[model samples]
Target: MSFSRIAFTVTAFFLTTSALTHAEEGKFTASPGLQLYSLRSQFKLKGVSRTLDTVKSFGIQLVELAGTHEMPIPEFKKELESRGLKAVSAHYPYKRWQTEPDAVAQEAKELGLEYAGCAWADHKSPMDEAQAREIAATFNQAGAALAKVGIKFFYHLHGFEYQPWKKGETLADLIIQETNPEQVKFQMDTLWVVFPGQDPVKLLEKYPNRWDLMHLKDLKQGVATGSLSGQTDVNNDVTLGTGQMNWAAILATAQKVGVKYYFIEDESSSSESQIPKSVKFLQSIRW
Candidate 1:
């Protein structure tokens, strides 16, 4: 080959290799955020300012708020802004969404959140179809109210919603069917899904558009599944890749289903130590 041609070929090879490496380095494309509730104890022990500093240190610029750590809404928003952190989503109580959705919308607006949701639906053990329908009605109403204020309303699934409803359907399915797709959306908490003996990928595929957000949590190995209790030891929460979850498949499916936001939520007592490892795992994962 001519010398000029040889030089060009070598340059092209190196450039292609570099591009591939760069892509692999960031295989998880969801730009994972943090759920501030993962640091709840820290906020209590170290206070909000110091706890926020810890969040910043983890290289997370986006967060999902549980509350303002008792700070006034405006003041909390300012604190987040000053530290270069943004609250993209938050979780409010189910009763608040049912009784005062407008108030919830106002608080979400004040906090500058784009999405607001309830993490757990208040229901009797082994949730039934009637309760599911009621919850769906509440979600639809709250969602519409929030939408009027330009904020999306969502529900974060806990394991309990998986109670059997009919032939090959669960209460979760009933709730999804009953809720308004455009008004009410869902957040798939990975651990909760897995703990209930459900597959995240299947659920995501089944209701693609309804899931706009995700909680990237993992259950510890050997934790029995098929439970509808929605109650588990917080310590069962584990770092992303170190747990029983098939992250490659779960995340790949989540991406395919158009989940817009992902948050790492470690409820274990060791969250401060586990979170960085989870972040690294997500960065390094390749599907």
Candidate 2:
């Protein structure tokens, strides 16, 4: 072969290989979706259309919903679709799941959701074993019903379930043990796990495959933890890497345990300003 032709062929091969490598890295390094509840105040103050525009401005294409901002379900779904946003999961009130799970499933289908969840268990303060068991039964029933409709069910831990139980186990442990894994799954809100003084990495290791989703939130540094109240000032939420979380360790464990979806959920009043920063941080993570 002519020397010039050999050189051209080699350069073309290297160029194609480099392009493929970068494409794969981009797929791996892309940031997770935003939880729409992060902008609850904006939705209320600026109206749904404007608030969603702000979300689209962040270059996010996937989202998790808390509610539809009172829009009809089909209308809300259409709005999301128009902006190239997909709703992978949504949270419904616990009562709605208990009283009318089929209705919840119907609405979830209308929104084209993959998973439906409850963010809080609605139990008395300092949640006890009985309350935890009751919550488990509700989840099991709702999960079964939702499963038939091709929607999975999940529970978002709210910190209060960390209350102590016998043999050094938590009420949270009891609930996990009682629920049917085939039907029920869990979402770990990083802030809630940290706020209640629990180790997210340890939990991920302790219960692999049961946690199907994650809320990528961070807690402000130097704040007190170990509260079982499951409540905190919304302002304690900070941008992803600017907070107290050891994100590398937590995310590594999450990936190892097969956690499927992640959403950046910043509930601070400053969410509008903070979300883009969070997205940048997530994109910078290598592992």
Candidate 3:
């Protein structure tokens, strides 16, 4: 072949390869399942088997636990497997586990969870610098305890944590620094991060590999700050794509950080209707 022709062919191949690479990298899926808390009322009405079947019908293949709904471990496992779903993680009260880590670990094992997480704990309000350090130490201790049992732990950040404690450092940052990543990771809630006047993308970028799970929730226009203390009408929870969060950017960053689970936590009164819609929206998303 002529040298010029060969060069042109090589250029075309490179361009095509680059484009394919970009497409694959940008791809995303709404695979992270529901918190079940999103559909608590529906689950109660439909019963566990029926609820899981409904969830599967929405194309959800995974879920995070809210409580076990008082089901025995074996019964819960059967219900989950019956619908071809898996529990990627679970949320339990920290104080409960703090006293009974072993029992908690057993339950997590039965549920087949990779992450056992706690949401919202107090570390004293208007935390001073010293208090912030103490808070970090407390988290580290909790994380270590969970880790000892081969159960991974996560700290689900609520908006109250966005407060600044020292110069150029926030409480969230301190938690990330203090807790060993091997012991504890973060589950970043998009709505919580945004409402606190902090950017989720920046948070993802700031902590490499620190976030493993995410709650794909959105804030309404007049809702209170990101703190869990603020109450918003659960009826307002909307489909994933329709929310105020810039999901494309958020998911893209999440994709970059290798976040494994993305739960659609629609704490809305319209959960039954919204669940299917949210699932369809998630299924429609390419990445």
Best model per TM-score: 1
- Number of the predicted model whose lDDT against the real structure is largest: 1
lDDT of 3 at 218: 72
Rank all candidate structures by their lDDT, best first, as comma-separated numbers. 1, 2, 3
- For model 1, the stretches where C-alpha displacement exceeds 4 angstroms are 1-26
> What lDDT tens digits, residue by residue, belong to model 3 across residues 1-287?
99999999999999999999877755465466888888788778877887888788877888998887778888898889888888988887866555666677777877878888887665566555566566566556666766766778887887777677568768778778877878778899887787777889989998968999999887665555545332356655676777677877888889887888899888888776777876676666654
Cα deviation of 271, candidate 3, in Å: 1.5
Give every collision pair in model 3: 27-287, 28-287, 29-287, 234-268, 234-269, 235-269
Please give the lDDT score for candidate 3: 0.77
For model 1, how does the per-residue alpha-carbon lDDT over 1-287 read when each residue is reduced to its tens digit? 99999999999999999999977653578778999999999999999999999999899999999989889988888888889999999999999998999999998988888999999999988677789999999999999999999999999999899988899989999999998898889999999999989999999999999999999999998999988899899999999988889998888888888899999999999999999999999888986
- Sorted on TM-score, best first, the list reads 1, 2, 3
Residue 1 in candidate 2 has what lDDT?
98
* Ranking 1 against 3 by lDDT, winner: 1
lDDT of each: 0.92, 0.91, 0.77
Q: List the residue pairs that clash in candidate 1.
A: none
What TM-score would you give candidate 3 relative to the actual structure?
Answer: 0.85
1-287: candidate 2 lDDT, tens digit per residue: 99999999999999999998876542224359999999999999999899999999998998999999999988998888889899999999999989999999989988899999999989878788889999999999999889989999999999999999989889999988899998899999999999999999999999997999999999998999999898999999999988899998898888778889999999999999999999888878754
